[model samples]
Target chain A: MGVVVTSPQFKDNARQAMADAPLQRALGHVRKNFIERRAAAAAGLPEFEALRDSARDIKNHTLAHLDLYLEEWERKVLAAGGHVHWARNAAEANRAIVDICKARGAKTVTKGKSMISEEIGLNDALAAAGVAAIETDLGEYIIQLRGEHPSHIIAPAVHLNKDQVESDFRRVHTHLPKERDLAEPTALLAEARAVLRQKFIEADVGITGANFLVAETGSSVIVTNEGNGDLTQTLPKVHVVIASIEKITPTMEDVAQLLRVLARSATGQEMSVYTTFSTGPRRPGDPDGPQEYHVVVLDNGRSSMLGGDFEDMLRCIRCGACMNHCPVYHAVGGHAYGWVYPGPMGSVLTPTLIGVDKAGHLPNASTFCGRCESVCPVRIPLPKMMRHWREREFERNLSPAALRSGLKLWAFFARRPALYRLATRLSTKALHLMGRTKGRFAKMPLASGWTDHRDLAAPQADTFQALWKQRRETR
Target chain B: MTARDDILANIRRARGVAGGEAPRRAAVEERLARAPTGIIPARARGDAAHRLALFRARVEAASASFATVADAAAAPDEIARYLRDANLPATLRMGADPRLAALPWAGTAIEIARGASDGHDLNAVSFAFAGIAETGTLALVSGPDNPTTLNFLPDNHIVLIEAADVVADMETVWARLRERFGKGALPRVLNLVTGPSRSADIEQTLLLGAHGPRRLHVVLVGAGEIGRQD
Candidate 1:
């Protein structure tokens, strides 16, 4: 899909999405299904918390020493007979990939599911260069056909329903019978498979994302439920792996720890159906594999995060667990977050990558529910991190002046316990008087955003601070 | 050699501030120290056999194959029979495994190709040194007998299992693997195959044959012996 899924310009698109009742209903169904499935998977494992901690430790340790691991990983990969390239950012990454394809005179490029590639807008770049970039992941292919950005990290088209898919298929596949039935999921799947199989066989360059880079062996681990990742990595003569630099681990044991948590958190599977680890190019006696292997490691604002307070953010394995559990993400989905990554991770990551000016509103989207933090396998304090970003945005003059002024005034009063207590008491009394009977405001002046969709209840006459004072005096 | 050294050097550069490595003996000792000193907690509830059976049932439910064998000695013959039943070629490029040397299957007339060289050969038999009952996974460590290619290249894969090696959970497997190989050692490949190679790439149709083995056969020798042997 195009990169416009939930641009900062998404208020208008979100309004449009809200207006479409059917689309909202479809998203609701999908949200509930994933939420329930994730809960069930988590409930079944007694060691889930322990696993998460271990996974977090592994990731943190790797990221903490990422440079070392990456260098070692590249060495092993090269030793295994693979070539490595470094890209400073998205443009460089895209250029390197396109150049490789051009060098090969590649006409068709098949891709596995890689959010990094999406972040770099690789397909559009390839297409602009007159190369055909086909997304082989079923969900990815569907979104690609619709010319939209992925709405979810793991399930890219989670926002689209069967009917919408049927419509897209019919619109695109003009060669199909005019009276063809697109109602069945199976039928839709069959159609997609038919269309993709031809592309897989004909593709000249295959590109994929690496789940983990093993420093000990120089292997790129790709875990997929569908074998498409294997095809995308092996079928074509040239295989290009576009992965974030943070994906490296020191050893297979470290990879194992991460793998244990990844699938269980993402789709609730003990392990994904396929976990293929490719080491270097095809060996001398090998058969039916890529002849050339190129791994492009993209830094893209990640290196800056090292040894910083946001260092914990690099521990993310892109499992999409935090997004799956986030309430705001469930309501608005990935597009609402407005970047390559979404959910709690996206809220923190997007602002860092694109700068707060472009994503000033993203960090404010959360309700501080703590569910994202609780569910994050890497233990990233996502809510706190977002707040940190918000603070940075304000300090850098990225936030609107009014918001900064209001926050400054609030902080001033909050620091003075007496003034804070007095102000809250007065505000509560005023709110109570405004809604004496209903005890709720329909549209408060300063809280139109909160009251637009739902009512905000007035606080009790006596505040907690006031009650505490009374109790202490009586004692 | 320089490439390897360069990689190590880069790592040293990246880890500019060395987080002092805990002594190897101390690390192991620390773990032991943390172990319960009192009466060990009651053995985790449920029969080991039942847990394994239930796990196998779950794996099958997820569309994977599972088998239990009495020992590694019987792996080759069971694998031979499975390949024969599938009507696959008898000449199998197999992974390197010292255990296969003891399997007296000369009468089976099956040709065995061994080592990493066999990775891309379409027909091969591979032995998982261990199987995780929790996920129905076969852990194939690269050695003389277990070649990395045997796990990745073959269109039809036969994984032999020893009942004694089945672990109840992934954590236990990790602990054991680490204890055996240390932190720095790694096999060329450590394939954890849960099922036959399958893909839903073509419009999510769930095609069984994509890149890896189209069929997976597990030769479970003695269904009742896993818990008892371990």
Candidate 2:
């Protein structure tokens, strides 16, 4: 893979991310904006919850018969004169796309904001192959100029402020007038639009990610607010779509159901500015569209997710709701997750796609607040999936020795309920006697991880079990 | 094994089924053939006039401007008025749509251009295939009639939507598409445009005109009611 997996260093990354003032300023936007907007959009539509259920059922049905649907989708794509290339993993997927671009003698390629492309490390692969890849999405363009991955899935540069973007543009785009005023977000958008417009025309190949691959019509759908995706795919001679295997929906009606909830959940828009469904290459007498249409479907360990507890994860539509509503994500921004995906969805998915060892910290980061599952458009049980990852980590002995022994010790006491109550009673009494004056512990043995960040409140005179038993007896 | 075969085999194994299991295949085939409809929002359901009003309201709420013209003949005057109001140039780019071609451009001083956009035009117009009232979406099919480039490569995108073509929901739009294009066949591109180009990526601040038309002005011909901007 071209992109480095910093997932193993997530704890350190999250530590640094927390201390970065500018990043914290940017993350504040997520904490305040997305939640209110989403609530308003959902409140406006009475059928929003029912539509979420429909979206979930459609995905469930499609996955249950995925093999069949995939075959059918491939047949329809071929019938429409489009090529479908299957990749077992990221490397193969990149190779297929690079070869397609190389065969067309492409020098520069334009790209819409596609998380799958980032997942497969396509831009780096293209750069190594001597092909320039230009990002067209406004947020993606900002991050690309700064040489960074997207902090958020939908809003790529959500971690950046306008000043940072202005500096990045000034630093990289020396061709433009040096004294150009980019004080406002609109000015930066206009500059990016003007710069990328030329690239859109000059590029030989264009690549995009598919939100849904309709099996009935053999079309790939992309939803965008800025219309960059349309420009990316329509301007180039060859349009290459990079999508995961689970992106397929059964029909256009299913696509309709999914789109109804996608924008509302992600950006709180009734609909995005552009939702394009591309069937194949430009037809005869068509004025403008790509001459070659290719779809590279990457499995990348997703097929293995089926028939397992992680199967619910495959229903995810990448709406960014889970991350937006996640308190942990708000506290430390997306870069702290240290991978392509960063939130509740990423916590469960990262472990499966990469390994639990590299991404074990992600699932453990959640507080189990359940806000993600509540806001999830497809109703993916994010916390449950994270617990599944924790179980897998324990099964593989991937967690730290200290945690394993702690859990092991707890399990031993739990098996003997009387002993558990006795041990807890003694510990509560000792803690109460020691910390009754302070009412909280600023420092504590064996719990420095908590005390280092915030004071751990002192235990009461009795444990919760003791209190519950006494209350029941009194009642 | 080839990537395709291996992926399929792995999925089948994971699901504990062989390829072409009769029940599974039948289920998929039936779904594909049936194209079942899910729960559509009640907001899009109403009389045609109410639906058109809803379309206008939603479209305007998305930061797009909407206007009503008496008929296709009045479209040119409305288009000219919009360009003048926005202070854009009198030049307009379009594709070879006969519906738009039949309009009397000679009555106005606006300069008309045709074919795909090469990223230089400031204003472009296209005819929408259908307008969904549920979300105020405009569906434009890519062909000689309406080049896909005009939909994105202009500063001001003016879409001409006929009142008769407006639908109650997206599901109805699908039915219309299937009838026009036939099952399992589609035009090279079918674009569903709602509002003008916008992004909230910069510190979560909403800004318009990011890589597409900053202004989306829809001329709803034969639709009497004007939409209110939220």
Candidate 3:
């Protein structure tokens, strides 16, 4: 795997995350802001849902014809005097990028927030090869300063409060006056801006992740609120774009449809401040742009995903809506999923990218509230996919023996309706009689996990089926 | 097989395609050839005057400064006023865009330098290829006429948008682009800038001028009921 997988220990990570005060304080921002802003933005647009359907259709069309589109895009890139390298995995992708920087003798490389770069661990790889990789995105830069992985995909530092960020800056930037009022976000932003401005001008190679790679024009599109991506690609001598195979869109019109929904879904904005469509490098007689343009096309297990049950995941534009509206994500936060990705989308995708065996705990983490699917811009069935992961886990016996045995016992009773009804009726009657004095039980047999947090409500005399039968009989 | 061939083969296998099927090929080719327009919002479907109004309102909403001029010849003066109002440098960097070059820059004392941005210019101007009313976006195509660097390097970016070039939505913008840069080809870069550069990454509090221009002032030229030309 490109990044280390602590996905197997997701339960422990989630437990730790739930108890972390600073992270919990930080997650409150995501919970309050993203939902309201997105709702307001969507409510203001009458065609928002219709546009989502259109965006989904376009992505589906592209993926179905991905082979042809990829071929066309490659041809167009080559025609436009750009270089395209195909990578089977993260290692190859990193190598291709490192070699490009080396060939240019790039001492420093400025980066625009690319999840692909994170997935490939390009920073460490570049550092190993003696190249300084500078993260120009504010969120990425902060996390990079802390030697931490991004929790949220879109807002990488969504896990940190302003105080935490101020401390991080203070710790790293010792040359600055310690007593400078780094209290406000504005002051912090200004500091980062001043710091990164020099790096942007000095870097030899610039790398950015593509939101969409247009097959029609051979353009790699990046949508960002900050203009960091534009400057990163424009000022540098060499520009490198790293994107997964599934990022392809067939045409500009298709891109338009996707872009309409992307910003609204991601950050609840009409459009991100900078939506750049970069074709080749600089043209003849053109001044002040990259001299060389290189695109590293990474497969990294996505091709196999297209043919499977998880193909719907490929339609994702990385808007982070699925995770944003997710109740489980809100509770445990992103780091709990314990990989490059987190939340419902990560649960489904991590299994495919890494493997269900390692990431089996992710799908089990969801509460199936279905908020993720409802807010999904492309209408990806995130919960359904997570269920699929659970099934796969069960099929492969990746689930614990106790869980398997419990399910087996339930299945034994469920196979026979009379036995199931009788068993449930008896249990309910006993519980009702036992807990008549109290409405709930503080502890219950064989269900300590449920009772440890809060008391389970005692069942009434009648089971749900019995109540239904009685109602039907009386009516 | 090479990685590319292997990946394609895998995709083909997963999609249950033989890779040479005529219907699939035709569908793929047709979609690319047609470049079908998708669901454009009702808000973007309005009269010329209405769209211009919407464009101004949206531009302001996105935290960009908007100004209207009577003609292209009035752009430089308007730009000069904007720089002066913002208390920015009188000197500006620009490209060889004839529309911009034709502006009566001599009317103002602002120093004008040509070519592209070297990351030192405090202010830069570029003539937009088109503007989208739905999001108040400036679609700038890269070339010698309007180098891409001028769009990002400066602290204040003053874009000269002809009122006539403002379109209803992004779809129309694409159609216009296809017409300008042939089918399946584009300029080196096409930047769709909505307001100034901003970031919410610092504790998710919105702050402008994170890396790009802190001030994005638009000079809308040639007023009146200017309908879609294409």
Candidate 4:
């Protein structure tokens, strides 16, 4: 992957993340805010749950008819005097955008927050071609200054604290006075606005990611809380939209259904502050808008996901609710996942984009508490998908020798119910007798991983299956 | 094969269907033409008073401010009053919208500038195409009448929402767009703004006014008892 991925080092990264005090402190905010706000927003709308069903159905229908819808969207875009460039992968997508900038003689380009842009490493590509790319989103700008990728999807700099951001601003913004009061997020935001505002006016090309692409009107929709996306696409002469193929929806009404669940699940807003729909470049007699419009639709392994076990993943609207509620994500924060995406969604998707051999550890990191799927707006079975990755890893002999032996040992007993039940009963009886006084073990013979952190309760004389059978017969 | 052809071929190969299947073609065409409205929130369907109340509540909830006026003639005065109250400049930038140009700006002390923003103006105003009650969103179409720049590139933005145009839900707004602009077609841009700009990038603390307007003030004109689907 052109985007430098440490996903293969996820285990080591997660270990280091748990020990980093500053990151741990920053992640506390995610724990406090997203869950309660989303709960309140979802509860406020009586139709919210029903709307999720509608959203899921719409995406399902779109994915089933992806070819026809893409054709219709392309035809409509051409009719609207817009150009559509097809990209088979990240390299093609980046080339299409850079070529557009080169044709327009664009020295600088302003960018809205786009995970696809990050996935394709667009900034590095643009730099290689001698074009400057300025990130206009406040979080993206902060991360761009720090030379970091986004830790979280929606909140790019969520892994950063106020002091870290303040320092970043001081380091980059040299023209400002040294002793000025840059002590607050508010001040940091104001400084970013002033800085990016200049870039927006000077930039010759604007690039943004589409939240959804409407096939009916050939429009690309962007939902943002800050108005950065609006300015990014509006002020520049050339506007280039980079989006994946799965973002296509059949109609505006279908988009409306998805929009209802998107904001509430992401940031707990009824609607994001700005939802702008752009069909093409500036129209005849239009006073202001982009003079030229181009859309770069990227495949990048998504078509393979369409009719496979992971087809449900395409229904995701990138709400970030999964990571927000994921316990493992909360412990290590988003950076430990070490890719453009993080948390439960990343666990499943990473293995697909990059091979399971590289990102196999991500799936095993989950505790499978099911909070992600329960809160998912489109109801993608994230944990189930992760399990699928784990199974595939085992089948491909990618698992370690010890783990393989342990699983094999368990599978042997699992196939023989009578012997397994007798063996478990004898082991439980022996453990119960040995630990009668303590009632728990700080260490076990074969399981040091569980006992390392906390004590393990000793099993009773009878197994749960035996106890259940006795209770039913007694009743 | 071209990238488009390869992608379509891959999708068809996985989906187990050729691209020319009549049933799939008819399904997509039907959905596009009919544009069926999905589940609308219960809060969206209400009486005139309830609609206005919910609109105000949701707008305020989004951290935006709105003032009600009896008619369009009072809109400029409202903008002037809002600027004065917020300790902002009394100057305003706007486009050539006939509805706003016809407003009685001479009745107020505010100075007015016209044309698109080059990122220099501190304040601007625009006429909205419709006001949505479900989310308290103002949908504005792109044109010389109401330049898109006035909507985003300003420190302060004041929008005029005609009460008669305020609708019950987003679905209503979609229906109106189809009727006015024609099915499967729209203006180059249609902006739906719900609140002032904000970001929660630093430590998950949400602060209003990021890159767009620091303050968004809406002048809801003739808002009393003016509600209907049509």
lDDT of 4 at B32: 86
Best by DockQ: 2
Ten consecutive residues with minimal summed lDDT in candidate 3 chain A? A1-10
Tens digit per residue, CA lDDT, model 4, B24-143: 999988898888888877876767777877787777777888898898898888888899999988899999999989999999999899999888899999999999998889999999
lDDT-best of 1 and 2: 2
Q: What DockQ does predicted model 3 obtain?
A: 0.81
Off by over 4 Å in 2: B226-230
TM-score: which is higher, 1 or 2? 2
Worst 10 residues of 4 chain A by lDDT: A1-10
lDDT of 3 by residue, B1-230 (tens): 98888888998998888888999889988988988888878886878887888888888889998888888877778888888888887999889988778878888999999998778889999989999998889999888899888888889988888888999888888888878888888889989999999998866788898889899998888884333322
Model 3 misses residue A268 by how many Å? 0.3
Error of 1 at A422 (Å): 4.8
Docking class of 1: incorrect
Residues A178-246 of candidate 4: C-alpha lDDT, one tens digit per residue: 999988878888889898889999999999999999999999999999999999999999999999999
**DockQ each:** 0.17, 0.90, 0.81, 0.89
Q: How high is the CA lDDT of each candidate model?
A: 0.71, 0.91, 0.89, 0.91
| Candidate 1 regions with alpha-carbon error over 4 angstroms | A1-6, A174-181, A408-434, A456-459, B1-55, B65-130, B139-191, B196-217, B221-230
Every model's TM-score? 0.79, 0.98, 0.97, 0.98
Per-residue CA lDDT of model 1 for A40-123, tens digit only, reads 777877777776887787777666566556766777777767788888777888989999999989999999999999888899
User: Which run of 10 residues does model 1 chain A get worst, by summed lDDT?
Assistant: A1-10
Candidate 3 chain B worst ten-residue window by lDDT: B221-230
